[model samples]
Target: MNDAEVLMNPNDLVQFLKKNPEYFTKDDILRFCEENHVEMVNFRYAGGDGKLKTLNFAVSSKEQLDTILSEGERVDGSKLFSFIEADSSDLYVIPRYGTAFMDPFAEAKTLNILCSYYDGNGHPLASSPEHILRQAEASFKKHTGMEFKCLGELEYYIISKEETFYHRSNRIGYHESGPFCRFCEMRTEAMLMIARAGGKIKYGHAEAGSFTKDGYYYEQHEIEFLLTSPILAVEQILIAKWILRRLSVKYEVEVSFAPKIAIDRSGSGLHIHLLAEKNGTNVLIKEGKLSDTAKRMIVGILDISDAATGFGNTVPTSYLRLVPNQNAPTYICWGEQNRSVVVRVPLGWVDGVDMAADANFGLKRRSEKATRQTLEFRVADGSACIYEMIACLICGAIHGLGMNGALTKADELYASRNIFNEECTSFLKTLRRLPISCTESADALISKRKLLERDDIFPPGVIDDQAAKLRAYNDSCLSERLRRDETLFTECAEQYLHIN
Candidate 1:
């Protein structure tokens, strides 16, 4: 038989990894490649925009493996925005062994390993998004002896070309089933695929925005994941998006994770929930109340709400979804169960009840002590890179934790009531609103660069580069709008009404 026909099965490799967790050494990989007749390996990494970049190489001998593991594969760093200048564009892709997985979709039997970017001298790139996130995690650990556990509620719209025959209004698709929920089977299959690929899927369901017309149908859906380490959570977000995009093409549908797909429709959001933990215990809760550290972190995020949006809400269309009373927060405030505020401490947990009512009654009571108290930051959308958003959040929390008594006062005032209510109008006058436009948000990031850049969490010039890029993007959008219709700039409110 030929060498290819005598090679070990990819499934066998997966099982081998599961059985022997210590098989991550270079020697082990080389041995496996030699014995299994493996032909190629793929190295992947995330760019500044969270898009995946890949490098592939043949794995014929042990010499090549040793060279790659020791020196890494060089790549063109200039391809990624803000990474490097054309004069010194050389960077290396060093594989992160823990992120190794077999490519189920590849035509050949290949192993895909996620990698990190490093400079020519083997130093980690400061402008690298993954590196920034790792530094943030390290900083948080240094200050509090705790790590962050994060979960993402990723929402998106799926449009199909198949005919629906009958039509429905654009505003009623929440928890939909049967004929109206045309994408149920597809979403379920995607969720299963994600689970099989090592992602922890919490749930998937239809959202509250959909419409059916002529021979096309558009529906909103959400896929929420369970809490995990910050790095793993971010990696899973990228993986989930990759799965969805691939499946969408297979199903003959178009998927959009844009913050706002239509002018007057429910916008998608990438709401993130986080908890601080130490020694396997959630540190955000103590005696059924928010711990001092938790309060400080929340207040810190609130203090830098506008600046943080530059990373979380990166695109001009993101601001269109932040209108008041549209299930999107517009004010710089926090409150329990208040969706109108930038930060929300969801209800049920505060009253000793789980927010997930579908759990078994007995099991719910049994796991009460294990329940974690989390803070949900609701401003970010899919336009932002997960790494950048989390890094900005950690920086803000660090600043907040070191603030004086003013942070406490802001929290107390915001938690008193719904800040958007008519009765709270007088109080709202004293509070700041989130940036009204992408330009303003970029300016906020520049103004608050010192606060975010402390301790090298964000390398020098990183914030400036981010702000310049955002400004250029906003300018492009504005120019396009002006060319389409001269009155678009003057009548933006009427053109992009908040209907959700």
Candidate 2:
């Protein structure tokens, strides 16, 4: 801990210090503390609100550090969640060694790792978000003999401290480098930090949304991660959010994930692409068309999109982002290459073309046909309870697989063309719609609670708590009121600008 001991740079990956970067046992983590002259150990985990919580321990000696890491620490559940009773609030937070990382901005040499909650009987707490996701995966694999994998398209806006010379038009700042995108450098550094913290990233880029707000400039950016298991994806996303918020402090700016930043500005969405795997191979694509299991998942998501909004769209103004023609889905439908529907089947090398051969001469190789097929659900946004949101989706998929008439429902909800177009107005009227208010979302969840409670993966307390909180907003009529009042609209939007 001396000043003369050279400090490790933040961009340096801590996994390099291990024999295997992907494996981190207790002995390996303990050896890291001893060999690297570590001074502090931090235990981080997700709480009821889906925010990362931390409890720090200063390593007085190797013995003290060992005990802290092995035995874990106790926490008050009542203070962290609304559903937990105050009388029985004691719970344990145990560290997950695989998530260890070097704290980038730490003044002291510190090692940070994520943790999981455990009950008094030394079992994972059923109400824990981490446990619920793990259970869902196991149940899904047991029932359908398939694994659930997801890819998240994380979107956010970076508000610079002052205005820049480049005047980005509303919803037109997609992929401009150097001068136009002022926050490109900051966004890239965040990507590196996320990578160093064990995130599998695909790419980062500018998005098609920008606006000046509250005397500051705001430009949109997105960082997409590669496909991973549902549990791993959720953890990576929470870590990414933590790193971005911390990095924003150094640059003296604000980073927000609110669904609707303004009335007409392009809202940020947490779009997720879901893939199904069986026997170590992707089963999502069959014979160059949508597979049966994949179709069921799409229909399942469409069936529960309205109810699932309780977990995704948390705030009152989130309803504003789901309006028609705003690049957000408003109806219960699926489509291929159409953005107007809730579930979209993107171009996934369906035609069997070797896309990489033309770009690289030496890399002229064909695909194994085991990957690249995905069904993207675009209903959720940034203010989501990520653990429950994903769990709900997986349950719906399982239910869809077992339900009758899935093929019929899928065909009925398929939209070949944009349903909002002038020619398809009558067709759009026939389809069902998403919830437009907090109250409506709560009512949908209340009615469809059995869907989520089927496998016991989703705790009843969590479901009840979520419904109660959503109903408490009483904002079912707020959207109608805000339409005629601009002053009140801005005031409501400002409160949630940095809520995530």
Candidate 3:
């Protein structure tokens, strides 16, 4: 789209607003077109597999939007990592009308649109992640009349572009604060862009990753932010990463969402906060009883832990952050405040302070009734496929709720602490660790859980292809002997489980 083709037409925009009053306003639409340097604006509806089944001009004076609508946008479908046949890579990126928004970062009146991949004839691409998530969500609702809400905390590290390899390599402990938290200015700029793009964020602040008073890194602090829904959170996460990457490039700093950077430093985690609603009430919390539905949902989560990990913590680097004794779970268990538990059902809303303080010893306590209660899952990382992971978790929970599985609590787990410890030891002896290389994970995924068989999240050959790419990624990392890996096998690390 050349510069001349992107201008907005007042008449078309006024008409567009009349049709979608909530989405577009004449002034907002005009500002969006003028600010983003967009060349054209169009809308499309695609099938479940991300195939564009239909495309039409929504509003555009620029020839670029019209050109793509008429001529189509081409992409190498084979390179999409989750699809088959790189040679049949020719695909189209059809812009979705409902997804259109202003890109605050672009110099021109650039409009942001969500797109789906499709064949030359506009057939939906099978196994598209977005489509798969929609299917999973629908299936879950069909089985259990329940909806899942998810919020993800993305934790990462930012380093100065000029920092030496030695400094980055060193385990700086809990002292890497102040100047070490590079790109504050850029982060603020990125936040503004994100806000303009409709990213509803609760707050953004410095995490514990800030260097300590003594100049060491305190890895435990997470940059927590609130989000409205799982889907929105996923979009915001990707955009945040994208924006951060751009900021890094501009500032000459390195940014990483990897789990572990050093042996002793705190590793990153993507802790997801989840809740459910039914009949306009909080199902996860009602009249003080943990709803039968909520308990069953927990069972489903435990059941699909293994399969979920492939997407939840997809990167090999994620394991580096899963070490033992890091107050992270390495076992499949739940406790009131036990950091070792994979799932923690905190007390009700009223007694939060006391419960949290007393439960600090890993004890379970009830709280005053509040409707905004939730459950926290502690084993995910930033590398996850947001759509896939959330869907899988929701489905598992739905399965549990539908089946009415046994709900295990913190006190019960501790009562059998010794037996559980012995079982953990025995299980460790027999259980295989996930692949440490991206290639290996991809390979294991191919041979063990072929993508096609697993609800078609990725195409038939996509897993294998992704695995190959992962293998290349692993080889590029420092050798295992000399590399600084997180303490994954230790006592305090968080463990992801698989349902057999």
Candidate 4:
């Protein structure tokens, strides 16, 4: 048996290092490696392009393992992100103990941990995504006295060459099982690994996107994570993508989190469900209705959705997924269970109707008071700089909190029914439309960046760099060009199939 497979405690793979869990420390990490005979230490972090990068170390002694965990290592930050200049790009990558997990794909017994970057002066790198998120979180808490929490519903398509039986029809495989959902096993397996690696996982299932194009079968699946702070939420999603990519290689299949992998087909969206917590209670809902805080937050989001596109929808293909009549939103609006709007307030189990009574005839209950009500921001896709995305959101909410007429704005923009429905055409006219192209999105960002810069969370250089990247695509005419040519349209979508 390989050393990686046989551990002193096999359950450690499922558990958090098999000790005082959740609050892992340097000593705890060292102890786990020594006890489990871990041979390699891998430090991973999310790069500027929203991808995970790893630095590996071969640990032979306890001293080396302790030193690695305590002091960490240095790397050229310019390579991971284009923001920093090469002359002064050396930054320290320090392992975050709480993110430690066993690497299932490593041939040797490997311990993997996510790291945060720091400049040579020992300060958090301002350009670092995680650092920016941390600052945003702190600023929001300081002003609102509530912690911003988020959950991610990450969707992606899996492509396989085999034309097997029970092929599902396009856009009809939601929550499917068995033969109908060909990739259920792999999906569950991915969820298991993600959970074991400190991800606050909710569930995994087949999504409503399946297609057979050009002799290759493309099916969609989603892995959603439970609510956590913005920092950990982003890390879990990035780590999940890394695990998916690793498994894809072993399965000899291709995977993509791209917004639009196929023209006129269902596009994958990284829908982010947001909430604010105070004293361990959700403040987004009060007495079964949207709270003032929630309303203000929604208005804030709508106010900045166009400019925020530079952060959420980074790729040119992102706009391709946001057309009207599709599940994606083309206008800025919010409503309860309204898919036509950018923000959807899905059913939140807030009825207090004991759901467990249906499963068990007689069951004891306690004072259950954890609210699942959240505002789902549906615009963000896979091709996003998640840190910047959440930071802008936090800033927007902060600004809305202070705005005198935010509540009125929310009421004015609320859609009782699907705005895209024929009957509501006149009402939809009142709502402002979100940007539809990379060029338009960048233009909005540059024009209205003050919303994101309210708390100095996003440095001007950061926003400018993002805007510059979007403008480089010059996609103002991309939609029209793709609409006219079928081959060019599909080819364009396929190229950006896996920007994550």
Candidate 5:
């Protein structure tokens, strides 16, 4: 472990302390541990073999760091999933101070800290989910001379695992609460867990198919929740799923982040919002037109759009939700206020334009603080690797900015028509289509090695391994021969614990 204290800037630390004020004194942590009857903190790390290997950390006084350091632990890194392979299965997890959060579900104040994983010989695991993001951040800063901040709105489902198929009676539309009216209590617990985990709570509520035919019954039972950024958002999704699953266990049901439950309705999407700052100025916001920098960002995403789709929606069935006619982005295009388009410059006031474009759009000069701008990239889904996906996006933006790729001269770039509207068909015709299956996506990844290989953005072996695994699975199952596999159908039911 590095001897230096974690050096977050004063402003960043203040931001953290502000959102999460439930700081625990060392005594508070030990006392809570004693009272809760909690014995150890579990640490999990990926081995080179790509399997999870877990260890436990004992609770002790702050001074125990030296003692704990003396009491070493060992695990085979080659068996871990994240690392490629390890001649030595040696890996250790050293907890960082100050990350402790009381587990709300524990009877006692059970504290947990995010652990750092290192190889037996003491090398940082490059494949750890967090490590991937850190690398992406480095690339982002180097290429764009800006720091990237991200936020997301996660949409998913919480349902009874018992009822596999709902016996349709009278058609109900959105928000028609019933057995599905499982929100109120779960929302309370979810908020508590998030707050305890040091995350600011954003509101959550029912989205489509509460009780209407428009609800699209079987497939569309879902909910939407928002989080401040990638780390917290992924954490919330995992925690929420766990909480909901336990609650469902009480009711004997299940929950999942799976993008598709059935066909013809919206699949869950992890829609991301990105902003870049250089020396405290919002790089993407200027005059009327998006900054050439922002445009470059968009171009990078558009260029390698296909290669990144593997993580955006991991499952083979994710493609069903990405059809051209459906809500998902089927092509690479950006327009103002368009959903069918992959990138959308959200509608805003004339003052919202970036300063770089202000002269062109003819806006009066205003303080940067008065500026508000947002860009939406809509390809991601629940199954994504939060770290990898965000890293790829940041890199893409950097690439775009470097190439001045946003210089594409479309006549009506600012048009605000609905992306799914009739006009989009013609405009979108020039764009590429999302792969219809996971195999297709994997294939694209294998085929486009050069594009992703630049900057060593995506490690080559990662893509190859993923593709080979998918191919082997498909080959074994003979999935192509079956129009729809019963196992896949059952897996969907299993995912949500809809047991009927």
Candidate 6:
């Protein structure tokens, strides 16, 4: 069967597992592999910097499959980050069967499974980004008896292969279909590929940003995902990125996830919409209004908004996007339908609003009730590690939920003003500004280590290592600017103009 057919009828595998009792056994996997003509399998994992790394092996026989299943592949963990020393750098990769999918971009028939990292002694790697997110997921569920669901609106820019000299106006690319949207067909194919790989894609569209320079025209676009469990969301994000990257190569285009590609242009953002559910009810919405827990979560996020910037906006270029009047958030605040705040509660129909008056009313209400109750975190950019970013957000919410008074104060202070306005600047001055640079954000993260390190969610020393890396990156950028005799803005644009 084709990949789509196989994924569509997942019950075939489910029934096989039910009959076998011991699913993913060497024999079972070999049988399936043979039937599917899977010549190779790749074990994939997230490295320290959240980049996906892989180890591929030919799976021509049952022996190979058995060997792979019984003896997981060893990797040099020290190379990944500060996870291990060279003397004892051994790590293991254990494949997750549920994540296995046919590689749509592979030249030959291949299967890819996302792997979990384990230490030399067979213990879970605490420094692993996936592990950190898993722990956070468990902790959040244990403490609140609720499932955390997340939907991501990932924005990126597609650059043309042929260079052009004409510079287009800024902020004019939103939903501009037809001739200007060169990569729309590729995006549609990517969405289909994502679905075949078990990802839920809500929609894809051109975003509000386009510019031409050095014979290349950069057009921004976004693909949004349906709400799913935290772990699934992370997995889907990785898969989506993989699809985009592979497809870009085929299309002779460059896809950049960088927050700000130009000095004076709209930057890409990864706006996360979060929801919490208890039993069968949406905990984020109570009686058609924001719940106390939801309010606290928002307050908690804003409380450590400066520190949290390190998690979402990791690169030096990320801060360039956060200026006032841009689509990016510049201040630590929340407001309904305000894109200028760190967190935005989009205005939609009330729970019981009439569908006749508004076409979107029923859809909005159904989404709130069944899919999610909304809070859009607008601060995060494309540079973030997906797992780490979500974990930090969850931790911040936990911290915020415990401080009722602080939450109340934050709600009173920020739930109304449009911080982008001149009138609100004075009020914004009272609230903390998100760190303006990578170094400053790293320092904030170091200061708030306690908040993120609670319950061992962050591996010991991982935060320190990440902070040091950020500082080094900042130092390198500074030195490069000085060496080139270029201003910081020009240097930033040069370094990040094509970065993915």
TM-score of each: 0.87, 0.95, 0.69, 0.95, 0.75, 0.89
**Per-residue lDDT over 94-156 for candidate 6, one digit per residue giving the tens place of the 0 to 100 score:** 887666667888888887778888987898888888889899888888877888788889898
Off by over 4 Å in 2: 1-14, 17-22, 162-164, 169-171, 360-363, 366-369
Query: For every model in order, what is the number of clashing pairs?
Result: 0, 0, 59, 0, 38, 3
Residue-level error in angstroms, candidate 3, position 161: 6.1
Could you tell which candidate, 1 or 5, scores higher by TM-score?
1
User: In model 1, which regions exceed 4 Å deviation?
Assistant: 1-14, 19-23, 27-38, 62-66, 165-169, 213-215, 348-368, 474-500
Candidate 6 TM-score to native: 0.89
- Candidate ranking under lDDT, highest first, comes to 4, 2, 6, 1, 5, 3
The residue-by-residue lDDT of candidate 2 on 223-262, one tens digit each, is 9999998977998899888888899998899888888877
List residue ranges in candidate 6 displaced over 4 A. 1-28, 162-171, 354-371, 475-491, 497-500
* Per-residue alpha-carbon lDDT of candidate 5 for residues 125-220, written as tens digits (9 for 90 to 100): 655655666667777778667777666665665543223244433343345454544444565556566555544444655555332232332323
Whole-model lDDT per candidate: 0.75, 0.84, 0.54, 0.84, 0.56, 0.76
**Candidate 4 minimal-lDDT segment of 10 residues:** 1-10
Better of 3 and 4 by lDDT: 4
Compare the candidates by lDDT and give the number of the best one: 4
33-117 in candidate 4: lDDT tens per residue? 8878999999998888788988889997998888888898999988988778899989999988878888978999988898999
For candidate 1, list the clashing residue pairs, or say none.
none
Model 2 residue 47 lDDT score: 79
